[model samples]
Target: MTSLVSTSHLQLAAFALGTVGWILCTFSMGMVEWRVWHVDNTTVISSGIAWVGIWKVCFISYLHISPGYKEQFCHKFSGYDSFIPREIYVAQGLLLIAMFVGLVGLTATVFALRNVYMGIAHKTLITRFFLVGGLCYIFAGLCVLIPVSWNFYSVAQNQSISFPPSYYMPTSPAAQDAGAAIPIGIVAVILLLLSGTFSLSYRFPVATNTTVNPDGINLPSAVSEQEQSQEIRTTSRVIL
Candidate 1:
């Protein structure tokens, strides 16, 4: 029992560290995409991306350090299998795809905004979509991690027998509890995909064209002709 408690404490520490690292990675990546690229600052973007990558490396390393033992140290403790179900792996793969898509969307939006300079509205829309998609990925990740944490707590508490004695047996209380999390993760992935689609759509004009002139000025045609004429007259008077 003492050994179990020690192991549980170690596992909990690892889970906490991994979660914090992942959160830092997510935040840094967002800063790279939003505050840096969206704001037309490449240096900050590069720095932020690098920082995120470092955090990701640390997160993965922590996962490796505590492999097969992460789910036995937190609330909702399920069992060992809950930490590494096939569905969880699939969800992780989907999250990677979503992350890639979001990064691509960010890059495209940044490039478009930088070159066009007048598509601020479009850029804003795309940025929002990317943000939503990224959040979906983050949420999905949480869903996966939660069950794993639960399983760790259960194992640490020596509650592995809460599951059926045999893996092939009918649904055990443990199995039922662990199974509940998979659907939530799937839902999150679906929402993320939908957000990614919306992000792509935002790249185009949804309404009337608000284009910029050669002088790099965005002109809304909704302005009255009289207003335009007055503006022209005012400019002429100023020049004279």
Candidate 2:
């Protein structure tokens, strides 16, 4: 007989799958945005952006809505979106703040990795690189969340408004400087790849062994008793 999955296990699995899908969708959106703005290809970029945006909205809505059923089946899931209904504006403001903070954190992580790779610090290079990459994708997700939450909160407050206008537009200078981040990201990735290559070449538990010879030792004879009456000499040497 096929084993039946419990409601809690099913909810957790759904959450895991949804999170993965959310990540992939956000990546697709980034590629679309980069091509549209950086490469100046409007047609394909526009279409890709629209498609990714629609899919992301639907996926998040499903996650938000499905918890209600899960709560009905299992009371533990009841409080997930409780604050969502009452604190819409506050939630949106917090989302924007998080997005800005994520952007700065990601940039800082990249710089930190650069320092490690340049021999400024003897730190674990791979860990720093992974941190930077993870933060990059996380910041990208925040980019998506800011607008989504803002629009949702607006709609919840006022149904008459179709959708909130974009709240996270890049300034002209920022848009111009966008190309610079790619080079930084590329350098971090290259450093990470080199660290991996080095790791693969090394064997574990390197050993060091040493030996000493007792035959080289000398002992003074009993004549030293009589010689003790004579003058003793001492010498010191210094090497520079």
Candidate 3:
């Protein structure tokens, strides 16, 4: 009997992890909390906290003229703002690229996994897809890793960005910390890395149909008895 082709459980696990990582990556990209700054004055800013992200900066504050109610305000980053730090600017570009690459990686993994479960005969092509997917995932993880590390270093040093006066934010935060997005991105990167390693582990299993001869040598069960006897006779003639 021919050996049965089957899906790799490791790659299936990899696909699950990569899918979760991709979702988290998307969330991290949109989240406006790469870094959080806490300020002393809550009278002007109700929340007394400011959020800075690759895409925008936001804070909750009372309307200056009508001070009874508070509202959240956000400023979207635009071309060439001196106030925005270079690290954030760099993160914007790199994270976007990472998201795209991760998407490609997920697509490739899906195709490979589907083909495997469907028992497609094109094993070589499926393996190539898995390799490409794994490489894409690793590259994507590295891309996110750069920005996450850069931002982490900045946070450890209490890096601050200057806001315009009209924004009503303090010149600098009393305290700053890395935000939810940073940790989320970090975890997502880890998952993607693991997924890449797992995806690369695809291998075909050896055939299970074998029997031990009287001499204790293992022989494939598919070998005909007539062929085995003929081989044994030939070997005996050679020995004589």
Candidate 4:
């Protein structure tokens, strides 16, 4: 006779936290206008003149779309009209893969919940499911982190070593800075790490020794009459 399983507070909390981190990480992926330039060079003084993202980069509307303030306007980049950079392409692929793995992790987490299954066999299965989910999240975190960190490092004036001649990073005034998405990705990675760690360490199936009756009497209070009589006699003998 199977019954509804109860989920512990710890299990629910970890799942919620992990899901939140995944959402934030995905949101950060779409935020563009990264690596904008703020130059005080004698030749130019442009502010927020470009838009860069993991997937694409474009110059802000320089013509009369929503003119006056270029910083307030954005233009769409296309494969036919604009040349896309290689690093951005790499970033896009890795970030997409990260999101895909995170989706798998979320799916596994659903089955890992205590209320989802209630047998000894299921107990072990759920634990393994959660363990796999946690590892996937860790992988997802690394995937996003790699691109974000690499992009930042590539542009950092003090830290940049020369890029290979074939895969050379272009010297753009815009490359001198980071973007809004950078901090957001950083926070997401931290949350994912914490959430996965907590999920991995959680102890479910707190009780290991569960006694079930062989005669279809599953209730703990329902024992054999002979056993009850023996228990009573043993109590009387102790009293005497």
Winner by TM-score: 3
The global Cα lDDT (0 to 1) of model 1 is 0.35
For residue 25, model 2's alpha carbon misses the true position, in angstroms, by 16
Point out where model 3 deviates above 4 Å. Answer: 1-7, 64-70, 206-240
lDDT of 2 by residue, 86-122 (tens): 3334334443443354344444444544443354432
* Local lDDT at 119 for model 2: 41
Q: What local lDDT score does residue 231 receive in model 4, on the 0 to 100 scale?
A: 84
Best by lDDT: 3
Regarding TM-score, does 1 or 4 come out ahead? 4
Candidate 3 lDDT at 172 equals: 81
Q: Is candidate 2 or candidate 4 better by lDDT?
A: 4
Clashing pairs for predicted structure model 2, backbone only: none
Question: Given candidate 1, what's the lDDT at residue 95?
Answer: 43
Task: In candidate 3, list every pair of residues with a backbone clash.
Answer: none
TM-scores, all models, native as reference:
0.27, 0.24, 0.83, 0.65
- Alpha carbon deviation, residue 228, candidate 1 (Å): 28
**Runs off by more than 4 Å, candidate 1:** 1-83, 118-191, 199-240
- Quote model 4's TM-score: 0.65
What is the full ranking by lDDT, best candidate first? 3, 4, 1, 2
